[model samples]
Target: MDISKYNFYVGTSRGTLLFNSDKPNNIQSAKSEEISEVTSLNFGRNENELLIGYDNGCVNIFDIIERKYIKTPELQGEGRVVGIGYVNKSIVIGKHDGIINVWNGKRNNYFDTHLDEKGTLDTLVCNENRHGVIGTGGEFNDLKLWDIETQQCIFKAKSLGHDMLNLPIPTSVRGITFFPEDNYLSVCATKEGHVLLYDDRAQRRPVVKFLEKKASYTTIACAYRERQCLAGTTRGYMQVMDMKAGKCLRTFTNFTGSITSIVCDPLEPYVITTCLDRHLRIHNLETKELLHKVYMKQNLTKVLVKSIVKDEPVEDTSEKEKVDEEYEEIFENMETVVSSKKLKKQKRHDEDVTDKPRRKKKKKLKQAEG
Candidate 1:
């Protein structure tokens, strides 16, 4: 597969850019003075329009075919626009003040609000079936699902708790994703350092929880097409988990700083992670191999890969490739074994401490001896 044809849209702290992922590394200036800091981005279904949400309460629409900035009346909000997603012809923008605004291309009065609280919109996800789900961070640590057609919140799940006196508000729910080919939802955040899978059709609590070291999870991506999920941790590690078994299958540790964004190639099923260390890495999920690495000058906040062709041929593997696959599988399984052992040891230590009897010194025994 020609990797160069894949175009990447990167949302940075300074602004956003379109870069050619192929050999020459061509960077195109997509947005100019329109945005000061890009907080989120979404590409239209047609791939012609690029929507960028800024930290200064502004969203810009760029025409990719025309190669010019298309003017949409600026979205007005009280806080920074943190998340953006596109479904059909409508644009969903989530703000830091816990407000979701749906903008249709036709009218100026086309704005529908879904959330009204004090929280940062961390991620906006549109499922393969075009279902809209929004994950909130900071003050409100919960995930809320919305029905786009009716513009109503259908379900809300609270996953994290906080102390009202010291911390006051809930910690951030950094990432949320829908499982592949199922109604399961995966949520990850800081403080607890665990990935939670919740069955939307059943109970309120999580169905399974996969714990990690004390690293804040910044981003997560579900390979709904590939039946796997990838999580990017604050400690610069990428954990690939099996969605069905709720297990951490592999860990990639090439990054030096916190991982800010993670995504899967829609067509290739390869994982791409961007980190504050200024490196973007492409990993093959099946073999756990690092395919490509690109070094950037700036701290990459978000990295998204756009598959040019919808119907690409799958690569056929030979006997030699199968041998390599076996080796990769062993490496991945070994990591899981080590992690499980560590968790077991930690649990045993906790049990030992809790089971220890308190020491009591009796004054009556001393008096009798005297």
Candidate 2:
């Protein structure tokens, strides 16, 4: 598999690290852009400009190509910025303490609001094609969709009802992401090891919910397919799920620590992941194979795949040639191999004929005596 086509950003404990997938020693000595730890990441309309949310609840606009700061909008807060995204010309930021801030560049103004004033949000995602809509959820809050323009809730998800024993199951949302192909569809992963799919047009409750045993999902990402989502657990169990069927389609293993973040390539069959084990990895979603792994030196939080300016396909034919060479090695002495097999058959025929002749001679001697 050729990974040289992708360029992505990984958020770490120190800062955000940039890497190209083609490198042999990616992120080996790559310096981070910011000093503060990155808590969230998003791309602007240009795709070249990146929006970085810091643990300090501040958002910075950075040009990934130029490797420079584009803008640092003035804001003061003391919470982790859990989400950052764009709507037309405005920047919307969601903090852990349920505070949501939106900044409009046209008016050079901003507004701030809270999600009911009390609970913390673990996941906040802006709908890409939904025209200024966003979704936010957490351990204490139910999954909700909001219209950023009016600051009103468009839909609110109801928590799971009582169990078979009549005991209410708690809601703990760990990750949330909008399906790229559908504006009304969104998926969420919870600490309770459940993945829920919601369509705001259908109902406030999830249309489908699937449970992955022994998996407390830490991160979730929507695959390029229509109704597929990839989920990663704290125990490093990763699997692709068919959200419509509510079943696991395939699983990718061999991870050592918690799966902190996941990102699927928009135009490729690759899934990029960052883990607490300090390794950035790319896996082939089609073959369930680990294509590349790079060690970053610190725990990674989030990763974003940048848009490709130009894509040049790279194929390594050396492996294919090596396999052909191995096949040739098996019968290097082709004539001798054939002769040896033939020689074994000849020996067996000689033994069979010699015994029969001996029996005939003995019978002829007995007949002459009679």
Candidate 3:
């Protein structure tokens, strides 16, 4: 599936603009000014409207077919809007002040609000089944799953305490995504470079955690029909993880800067990632090969690859083979008895030599006595 037909809307500190990816990397300037540093963006499910959430607490909707900005009267607001998602005909805007505003597409009215007055909204996501989940990236550091219709928090996963490991301190949950068919939630952070898998039906602790030391995970997407998850890190690395086994399946390190966003091709398992290196890259899931790369003048913070094909698989390696290779590496790194015994013997030898009497000490003591 080719993404050449798709146009890109990028939000920057200066303003927001539309760029045709098929063009010569030149942005078609939109009329909006000072777009509040777009922190998150989402297109409507039917591709009718494009939603842009900004740092200055404004959510703007644009008409894609008509190529005009829809002047939604009630949708205008002033808060640090951090995340945006579309569910059915509803547009969800998550703000830095911890309020989730739901907007109706037909009427263009503010329908509901899910407010957590204590925390900040870090990420907002909606699955194929229309289940909406919000990750709060503040001192609370928890994931809240809500019923969009009722605006009630159905489930909550609190953050694990600090001092738990030698890993970096977690800033806030940068992103959260649910498995396509399962009850699993993939949680990523801005500080700790790890993807945590938590089962909603189970207790609070994560069932599996995939930790990497390179950089923080800024965004993640699940494969089209598999249990694998694709993640983008701040260091410009893209990795696929099998949530079932809690291991990284494949890794691609081609981007020159931090990866800000990632999304799976709607039709296939191919993954698309945007980086601060000012490039958009498409990778085939099966082969872990980069299919396309488009350089841009703007540092892309988010990317979405809307697919026209429905149910085709991208060519890549098998999941089982990848898992086995990861397992082999884990076993190879296991400490051996011989190494443990040698370390103990060395410690004992150093203690014995230190405990022996020193002629210099005796001479100093005699001098003091005299």
Candidate 4:
């Protein structure tokens, strides 16, 4: 639909493609240094810089304005980076070994710590309204909010027991995001195919737990202005969940594999999703319509939906029309001129043949009579 306010960048196994949401087929590709698969991506506060983490445990910073790689920060862990967030002048990275590393531009050895050794960090996000609040969760990690200033976890989701089956439900979070308008509120996708909403002010329990899909949910994204969210499953199904009602409003089933990432457009009624099927699809949030789809050759693991670049040039329809008109006029003139020249040459050849025949006949008749 109307995606003039945002640019979409998809991270695939081979490389990344930067393009407009309106024209996803037309793309500008950028690859990682070693061509490693991009595992996570996050943009800075101003949206001027992008941070990319690869499967090889290497991170690269890119200047969006220049559309070039700026630098690669030294990461301590030797595993895939699953999550990335921004805080003031530094960035926080969540690795597969459950290690959270913070790095600024100046130093290599800045802030590093492990949350857990058993499970990987599957989701990471920051509260833009609250500077120090950061959320991280994964398998057996539950959901925890960290205070970046104090470097401590402020809130954590508790475990719950099953009722009739006596089965234990471990809080394995697949994705996390804070409501853009409220820093106190955050949401996460669970391994049980449900969405959980948390309030920092009331940490007693989750305010609501909405079941989105039948399969495990691998990613979740909060809408720009509404209390609605988008959730993707391991089965490639996408669901639109309403946090206020704690129910699923709609479902989209077109992906052939697990959904890797989801992002909502801030200014438009659209959502972008990247799937392990090597395809990216943009959908209309309100109308429940498929807007644009692109088939990437590589398996996509993540995507960074960037803000719009201001003052972009609009399409010049007038120039295209003028060129088309000039081409048609030149073609018509050339066709008429060629036809006229052929006719004139034919007439001259016919006259010459007639006159030559007459002259030959007269000479032969005179010879006969003499």
Candidate 5:
């Protein structure tokens, strides 16, 4: 696997882990700033900066190159920072107690929207195309989208009213994501193994629903292909669901434990996931193959990836290698021909090859005696 093109940072159970794909073994832990468990994290305004959200309700920025904290921003909320997303020039923070705060690193507070303190806000994500748009969801609460600039709820999911037994279906949303291609299209995964896709421009309810029976999907992300999504379950498996066909396409297995977060490359065909099993792994979405993995001491909660998109075409040498290998078998059993071409040229001077030099010496001696 060519891991040189990717760059990312992992937020562990204790602190942040500075990771490099080029040298996966050369890892550095950031234990400064007196911060506790890094609950959530995302990239700041640029690739050189990273935004960190701690369990103690503290938010700070760190320089990736300097390997130090730039500044810490005091939060007005009072809960574990469960989720974070950077949009526009500010960051949208979601606390465990269901408080959504948008801060621009200034003194004044932008807006503090409440999302049902009864349930824990487990997931939050921002759209890649829109700056002000962000999505949030949690236990017992359906998904909702907010516009930070306007400070209004632009969209709220309609609950799946009741089950066959007449009990209200629980909406324990564990993961949420926005599509990179179409910002209006979004998806979320729930504890009940239900993955729902919502098109805000179409309706308030889920336009499509996929069920991964008997598995608790912990995190969700966009897949390698369009009209498809990837999700990680508590059963130690990652599912690739075709949102367009409404069925699971493939299941990636071999995870040690429940996955904490899943990140898919937008421009590449690779996916990375953080697991409670204390390992960071990258997988190929097309082949469902494990490309690379690195072990860490703590459970990984979040990962911020840096993708370098290129326009050049990649050459495939698989067919060429196969052909060369087939031709090699013909010569492997053959005898060693040491002088195939070199001895053929010597055949032309066979008669006078060595005697011509002796004959010239004899003529010189005769001329000197005469």
Candidate 6:
């Protein structure tokens, strides 16, 4: 809530967890009683208020300062909510059914729009340079731009023409972000592990593409540098690249699974990432060094970090060392735990195969031949 302090909120399977960001690494977590997982998280028009979307089709607003939920607004449709963004005092809900609901307030004032009807919505971004302009991307669909006030689709990217060797380009978008300096310029990550920059005003095709064989980017952050940005990939790595030069500057990896979401601390040179390995990591953007890491009980999907460097150091060094030792044990078990999850999934698949009926063999004909 307080922008001056170092803090953050993490969205997980059970609910949201608030990290105190203290030197000793204290955590305060809140679980939703009726929800199985938190689908989306956004800061409202007021920075102190947080809007949370649940898998059970409920939207709740919370005050970050008081660490308390304010209200639960009624939603029109019920489905798995994927992405949420706050713009112009309204909350935009991106659902798994491809429905984008724009709710103004708690009085049931909302409007609906469709994204990718066949697939789940993957990312939603509000333009910092352009008012009323928003972007949405899905699993198999291309990126789309819309004006929420007018409730109309303004732009849709076309599949790129050809590759260097005359091969067709892939258009499935994985993550998207608008350039803060220019409203017409936007960047997106494709399923092919490529980062493409699109100029909405100039042409439908991308202006530049980078990281052809690096990693499958799942999420991106835009505030790390002036002409460069950071992107989190499906292979549990993060890369910083120069958009104009189409070059990768650095890469960071601290998790064993996919990086789901990333946020850059505006006040410090830090980047926070949430991963499917049930870890939240803080790293230096320039040095690519791990500053601090926390292993939550649930897999974190999204993270909102405020600050990384505290103004004053804690007096007790033993307390900090004790917490770090505990986290080290937790971090050491992350890989084993994640592997167990994969084993469980494989076991379920094996059970499904064993559930099928097998054909019986004939006996009399074989005996006569013998």
- Top-lDDT structure, candidate number: 5
Question: Which digits, one per residue and each the tens of the lDDT, describe model 2 over residues 232-298?
Answer: 9989779899998999999888799999889987767888899989888988899988888888778
Residues 1-370, candidate 1: write the lDDT tens digits.
Answer: 4567577777777775656634535566565675467767777656777887777878887776677766566665567777777865677777766566777876432333444455455566665453555444444546666776666666676554445565643445777676656655645544456677766678666666666757668878786454477888878788888756778787888789988888886657588778888777788877878888777677778776776656877676787799999999989888444588898999999887776642223555566789
- Scanning candidate 3 in windows of ten residues, the lowest lDDT window is 107-116
lDDT of 3 by residue, 120-184 (tens): 56676765554555444443456666776766666776556565675534545777776767655
Give candidates' CA RMSD values in order: 27.6, 13.8, 26.4, 13.8, 11.4, 30.0
Q: After superposing candidate 5, which stretches have Cα over 4 Å from the reference?
A: 110-112, 308-370
lDDT of each: 0.68, 0.80, 0.66, 0.78, 0.81, 0.75
lDDT of 4 at 237: 89
Q: Could you tell which candidate, 2 or 5, scores higher by lDDT? A: 5
Model 3 regions more than 4 Å off = 1-13, 21-31, 74-78, 105-118, 130-139, 162-171, 183-186, 309-370
TM-score of model 4 vs. true structure: 0.77
Error of 5 at 146 (Å): 0.4
Ten-residue stretch with the least lDDT total in model 5: 107-116
Instruction: Point out where model 1 deviates above 4 Å.
Output: 21-24, 108-119, 130-138, 159-171, 183-191, 224-227, 267-269, 310-370
Residue 151 of candidate 6: its Cα lDDT?
78
TM-score of 6: 0.75
Candidate 1, residue 122: CA error in Å? 2.9
TM-score of each: 0.73, 0.77, 0.71, 0.77, 0.80, 0.75
Q: lDDT tens digits, residues 224-267, model 5?
A: 68878888988899999988877998888989899888888776
Give the per-residue lDDT digits (tens) of candidate 6, residues 1-370. 2333567788887766555545435677875554557777877877788878778777778777777776566666658776778877778877666677787775444445554456556667788689888887776567788898887889888877778999866666777887777788889987778788889888887788786575777888786567677888888888888998988887786679999888886646778788999887878887777877877778888787654454685579898899999999999888654588898999999887776433222455566788
lDDT of 2 at 142: 81
